[model samples]
Target chain A: MGGGKEARRGDVLLSGEGLVRRYDDATVVDVDSIEVRTGEVLAVLGPNGAGKSTLLRLLAALEAPEDGRLLYRGRAVGRDDPELRRTVAAVLQRPYLWRGTVAGNVEFALKARRLSASERRERVRQALQMVDIVDLADVPVDTLSGGEAQRVALARALAVEPEILFLDEPTADLDVSVRRRLLGDLERIVRHAAPAIVLVTHDPGEAFALADRVVVMEGGRIVQAGTPAEIFESPATEFVASFTGAEFMLNGTVSKVDEGTMTVRLESGASLEAAGSAEPGARVRVGYRPEDVVVSLPQSSSTSARNRFDTTVAHLHPRGGLVRLRLEADSLSLEAVITRHAMEELGLQVGTSVVAQVKATALHVFPA
Target chain B: MDVLVDAARQALALLLSGDPYLWGIIARSLQVSGSAVALGLLVGIPIGTWLGLTRFPGRGIAVALVNTGLALPPVVVGLFVYLLLSRQGPFGELGWLYTTSAMIAAQVVLAAPYVAAITLAAVQAVPPELRLQARALGAGRWQALLLHLREARLSLMAAVAAGFGAVISEVGAVMMVGGNVHGETRVITTAIVLETRRGQFATAMALGLILLAIAFAANAFITRVQQAAPRRRRPLTS
Candidate 1:
C-alpha cells in the first residue's frame, strides 16, 4: 500500500472509463480511466477548480458523464441504478442537513432503503455512536454547531452501511482543531468500517493522512496517481511539486556530469551535488522540502550532508509547534522548518549567519 | 358617526345572538374558499415545484407567466367563467352558470395561480444542494422531491393561507358567477355588498367585521407558521 505501483488490496468495486463531463462550453472533468477497489481510500487531490470535486460527482453518480461507461461490480449502471444507490453514500463539504432531529436525519438513509423501524433505530444509534455524537441524536440540526452538524451528516451517511463512501472535503469548512479531531475520527472509522472511499480535497495533508493512493488533478485531468510517499518524494510535474508543498526551489545550471550524479552551479554561485541525469550546460530547477534542510552555526562541527550553503536568516516565522527560517544566500533563498526547541538551543535570530545542509538525494531536479 | 355607532352595536348583537342568516353566509364563504384553495393546492403545488426545480429554454417566461397570474383580476376571471358557462358557451349544456360549482370554478382559477406563484417562490428558496444531498443519501427521485417539499412545508402552508385569504375575501368573481342567491350562493362578501346596496348599513358593517376577523385570523396563522422556521445561529469558530 505504501508503494506507488504496488498491487492494490481488493477487487474493483467501481470503474469509470473515458469519462467526460462538460458545463456550458467548458469541460470540467475528462478522465480516461479510474477505479475504486473495495476496502481502499482513493483521494483526489488538487488546487481549487482542478475538477477533483467534479470527478467525485461523476463517480458518485450525482451527475452523469456526458460520454463514458460507468461500471459497478463489472456491470454497466446509470445514476438511477438501484444497486448503486443502495450500496453508495456521500457527504459533502457543506452539511446539507434536513429539518429534523439528528436521529431523524440519520434515519433518513435507512428509511430511503425501506429498512424496518427496529433496524433503522439500531443503525442510527450505532452510526451516531461511531461518530461520537450519540448525545446529540435528538437535538435539532439547526441548533447544533457547524462541526456537530457535519458529524450528523457523516452519521447519516454511515447509517446506511454503504459499501462505498464518497467524501468531498467533509472537513473543509471546519476549524483547524475541529477538523483535526474529525479527521482522526474519520481515520478510525475508515479502518474499522473498511469501506471503499473516494475522498476529494485540496488539502494535501488530508490526502497524505487518509489516502492509500492519491490522484492529483489539474485543469480537469488526473495528472498523477500514486501512494502518499511516492507523491511526496517524487512528484511527476512542477505543479505536483508545488501543490505538495515542496517550497524550496533553486535555479541552477549543470556544470559537470559524473556517473549518475550531476553538479549544478547555482545562480548564487554555489555549486551543489544532486542525483539526476542531465548533460552539462542545461538549466534546471531543484526542489526540496523545507523539513529536509538542516541549519547550523558556521562554527559547528562538520556534518556529512553533501550540499551546504552559507546563508543568513532573513526572516523567522513561528508556525504552530515549529519555526520557519527563511534563509538567504546572496540571491538564492531557501526555507527550513525546525522545532522551536532547536531554534532556542541554537539561539537563532533574524540576521544570524547559518549553514544550511541538504543531501543530494533529497533534491529533485527539473528542466527549467 | 351616529350610523357607525348604531351599526357596531347591531353587529355585536347579531354576532352574539348567532344570527342564522349571518352564520350561514360565513359557512358558505368558508366552504367555497376552502374547497377552492384545497383544489388549487392539489393542482398548483406540483406544477410550482416542478417549475422551481426544472430548467428549460422558456423557464423564465413560464415563471413570468405564473407571476402574471398572481395579478389576475378576479372580475376578469369571473367574466371568463361566465362566458365559458353561458347559454351560448361551450359548457352551457351542463348549465352551471350562477351556481356554487361555477363560483368554485372561478375562485379556483383565481386561487391556483396565487398558490402556484407563491409555492414556486417557496420551493425555489430551499437550497438546491438539499435535493442533491437527499439523492446522495439513497433517496429515489420522488423521495428526494418529497424531502424538498418537506423542507418548504412552512412556506407551502403560508401559500395556502395566502390563497385562502385571496379567494375568501373576494366578492366580484363569486357574485358574478353565483348571482348572490339568497339561500344558496350568498356568502359573507356578497351578502355585505347586498346589504350596503339596499342601504342596510348596520348589516353591512356587521358582515364586514366578520370578514375582517376571518382575514386577520388567517394572516395570524400565516405569520405564526412563517416565524416558526428556526432562526440560523451564529456559526461556531472553534
Candidate 2:
C-alpha cells in the first residue's frame, strides 16, 4: 500500500474492537481498536509487562476477551469457530515439539488439514526446506538446538499455509547472528506467502527492520500505529517516541509562528525551528534522534542548510563504533552521536565548546 | 531369633519352588489389581486431562476432592463397598457380594482417584504454550488433547503405575469384598493376612516379599518409561 488510505484497504484480516481482558482486578488487555491487514506484518512493540503477550493470546483465541469482539475476515470468531480455527497459526515465544520425529511434527499440522499422505509428505518436506532444516526432518524433535527448533516450529505452522500467523517474540532468546538469520528468513516467508503477520517483540531494531507497520503498546493499550518510517519521522505520542529510541526531549515555549513552521525557544535560551504549526506562546516538546545531531569544532561556518548552536560537551561515552556526547548550550542539554574516529579527529573532550548542527526537518514537535 | 531365621529360609524356599498355592495367590492379585488399574486408566486419564486443560467454576473443588481421595483409607472404602454389596443394599440381587468382581469394584474405586489425581498433576505440568501452539497450528480440540497426551505419555504411565501400586497393596477392600476364598479370591495381600492369622508366618512372609517385588518392578518399569520419554528440545524450525 502506497498511501494511508490504501493501507487501510487490506481487508480487515483481524480486528479487536473494544477488546478487554481482565484477570481478577487487573486488566491485562484493553485495546479500543486494532486491525491487521490481509498481507502485512504488524509488529507490536512494548516492554515487559506491557501486555504484548496478552494481546497476542487474545488474538490467537487462546484466551477469550472479557468484553468486545474479535473479527477475523469480517466474521466474529471466538475460539470455537472451525472456519476461523483453520485459518490461523501461532508460533509462541517458547516453542514446543510433540513427541515424534521432526518430520512427524510438521506432518501433524498437515494431517489436521485432511491432506492425503502423499500430499502431506510433500508439504512437510517443503516446510522443512523453507526453514533450512530439511536435514533434520528424520531426527527426533527433542534433539534439535534452540534455533533449529524454532525453525521447525515455523515449518510446522507454515505447512498448513495459514491465512494468519501470530509470532510471539520468535527470536527473543536467540543469539545475535542466529536471530538476524531467522528474522531474514521470516521476512522472506511473509513477503512471498503474504499471510497477515502479528509479530510481538520488545526490540525496536527488530520492529523497524521487519514491520510493514509498527504498533507501540503500553499499559495494555495501543498508543500508536503507523508505518516504520512514519513512526520514526514523527511519533504520535511521547511514549511512542521514547520506545523508538527518541531519547532527548526538549521542553520549550513557542516564540514565533512562521507560516506552518514554529520557532520554539527552550529553557537553555537556544531557539529551534520545527515544521508543525502551533499558536505563539504555547508550550511544546521537541525531540530529535541522537544520530541526527551533528557535532563540529567551535567557530565552524554557519550554513543556510543547518540549524547550528554553540555548545560545550557535558559528557562523552563511547559505544560500539560511535561516541555519544551530551552537550550543554545555554542551560539546555542535547545528545549527539558521532563516530569514534570523528571524535578522535576532533579531539572532542568534556567542557570543550563545539557547534551542534541539527536539521529542522529532523526535529519532531508535539503539543505538551 | 532362630525361629524367625527358619521362617525366612522356609519362605525363600517356598518362593523358589513356585508353589501352586503361591502362584494362585499372585494370579488373583494380578486379576484384581490389573482390572482395577485398567478401569482407572480409562476413567481417570480423560478426567485428568480435562481438569488440567480447561477451567470451570468447580475445578478447584474437583482437584481438591481428588487429592482428598489420595489419602482415603482402604478400610473405609472397603467398608463402604461392603455395605453397598451386602444384602438389603442396592443391587444386592445381582449377588456380587463375596465375589472377585465385587473385590475389583472396590479396588477400582480405591485406585481411580489416585490415577486421576496423579494424571492431573502430570498433565498440568505440561507447558500451556504447547496446547496453544497445537491449537494455533490448526489442530482441533481433540487433536490438541491427543498430541498433548502423547507428549506426556511417560507421566501418564506413572499415574497408572501409582494407581496399581495403591490397589495391589490394599488388603481391607479385597478381603471384605472377595471374602478371601481359598482358591479364588486369595490375593497376595489378603492371603498374607490370612496365613499370618492362621500362624503360617513362613507363607505370610513369602507373599509379603512377592508383593514388595511386584511393587518395585512396577515402579522400575514406570521409571524406565519416564526416562525413555524424549527430553524437551526447541522445534527444528519456527
Pick by lDDT: which candidate is best? 1
lDDT string for model 2 (A1-368, tens) is 23332324467778999999998999988999999887689999999888999999888787899998998766788896887788888888877888778999999988878999999989998888888899998988677877887898889888888788888998988877889899899877766544688999999888888889999899999988899999888888877877787865568999998887789888667788888788899988888889999888865646554468788999999999999999988757889999999999898999899988888888887778
Model-by-model DockQ, in order? 0.61, 0.55
Query: What CA RMSD would you report for each candidate?
Result: 3.3, 3.7
**How would you encode candidate 1's per-residue C-alpha lDDT over A208-289 as one tens digit per residue?**
9999999999999988999999999988887898899887466889999998799988887878888877989999988888
- Evaluate all candidate structures by whole-model CA lDDT and list the values in order: 0.89, 0.85
Q: Which ten residues in a row have the lowest lDDT in candidate 1 chain A?
A: A1-10
Against the native chain B, each candidate's TM-score is 0.95, 0.91
CAPRI verdict (incorrect, acceptable, medium, high) for model 1: medium
Judging by DockQ against the true structure, name the best candidate.
1
Candidate that would win on TM-score: 1
